[model samples]
Target: MAGGMPDRNFLVNVFQLVDKDRSGAIDSRELQSALSNGNWMPFNPDTVRLMIGMFDKKGSGTITFEEFGALWKYVTDWQQCFRSFDRDNSGNISKEELKTALTTFGYRFSDKFYDVLMRRFDRSGKGVIYFDDFIQCCIVLHTLTPEFRQLDRDQTGTATFTYEQFLLVLAKILH
Candidate 1:
């Protein structure tokens, strides 16, 4: 949601690619198919469900051109943010660069915490985070932050929550 509006043609093309059935809209199955086929970074079903709920303003259960345009812009913005923080153009961001970038963007966390985050996203064990993992990390972090904060009310930086709480959080994020 950070980039300028995407071009209509580009959105249309993306929509067409995802909407393999030519039904003029994309459903969960189609989206999963596209992701599985490597047209996307392979989001989880929960993420896909959340996205459809967020972008399908008409409550149609399928995404149209306007919805897809918004989705595309969101992805492009994330990509831009990732590229900006990558720094060395290595197609990955080192832990140091990630720390600096997050700090520049006003995030503050302990070095240990940052290392944990970086390790979680560094799937290749190469001490760097590629774009796909970065995207997943960002999405999961973004979706969970509010609920995490709500549960961690004492500012202890950690909290115990029930399975019910987890489901509630997931539902909130998806809806």
Candidate 2:
């Protein structure tokens, strides 16, 4: 709202969500759970079916971890690129809001990005992204982080991965 837009972590969030059993692969119910939980809306059978069609990249009817991962990256990147549109956090991001945010984020103009996002997330087609729409955005943000950036080969940035940018960041864990 204030600045351009803030991109949030999508895929990482979804991975934690859909992997309910912690097994990595998404069974039908798990994907349904993730989709439902992604937004605050009531779960409709038709919505679920449409989501399966959109998010399930493998056409497997169920989602695998890798497939989920891919979907997350695509969605999240789009969201990150245009998050500022949601200035009120009212679960609805308006088009003017989106344009302002993108401007602040350094993208002076991106008609294609706006068009595609509007087509997908704006269910009402009112030029605003709602809660479920935002969730879809987050799903794609999951894979935008690059492995090299994870290492920060330049050593200019922080050593630890904590914030949104660390969505795909690799962390060393101790057993």
Candidate 3:
């Protein structure tokens, strides 16, 4: 578990709440429902599926209590990272702040590249990254960084792909 999450009872309550079928685990349907409810933040089905796949250590097609704990820790860490770079505490991160945060995480993205990222994740059209948007950004960055590097073999920190190559890359990233 991540640091400072000493509230075991609270965690248990949340786990139970999410375990909608009382099956002692959370499946993809339940997890997707919880994430997409727009209660805390919004997550698309694909991202939620990837998240579940990441934490389903037993390969059981569901997450047990122990796995849920790990997921909680992971999300908490993301939240902490977002808060740290959101220096104004305005519940949003500007494009510049996002660029800096990603840079700190070792992603040397160009301004134009970051703009493309913003367009993809910033669905709210508010010109700032909210919690949900930030989560998706982190997911995409963590999951697709290797693929991005492979495509950017020239070390230019940016890659341009043909329509066919773009589809191929998208397929790789989503699955």
Q: Between candidates 2 and 3, name the one with more favorable TM-score.
A: 3
Clashes within 3 Å, all models in order? 0, 14, 0
Summarize candidate 1's per-residue lDDT along 105-149 as a digit string, tens digits.
656889998899888877767888776666666666677887798
lDDT digits (tens) for residues 4-109 of candidate 3: 6547788799899989999999998887666532335555666667778888888888899888887877777777787898888877888988998988988876
**Relative to the unseen true structure, what is the Cα RMSD of model 1?**
4.2
Off by over 4 Å in 3: 1-10, 32-43, 59-61, 148-169
Best model number under TM-score: 3
Ranking 1 against 3 by lDDT, winner: 3
CA lDDT, every model vs. true structure:
0.75, 0.54, 0.77
Candidate 2's C-alpha runs over 4 A off are 1-17, 21-24, 27-29, 35-39, 43-51, 54-57, 87-89, 98-128, 134-175
Candidate 1: give the clashing pairs.
none
Ranking the candidates on lDDT from highest down gives: 3, 1, 2
In model 1, the Cα lDDT at residue 92 comes to: 79
- lDDT-better candidate, 2 vs 3: 3
TM-score of each candidate structure, all chains considered together: 0.70, 0.39, 0.76
Report the poorest 10 consecutive residues by lDDT, candidate 1. 35-44
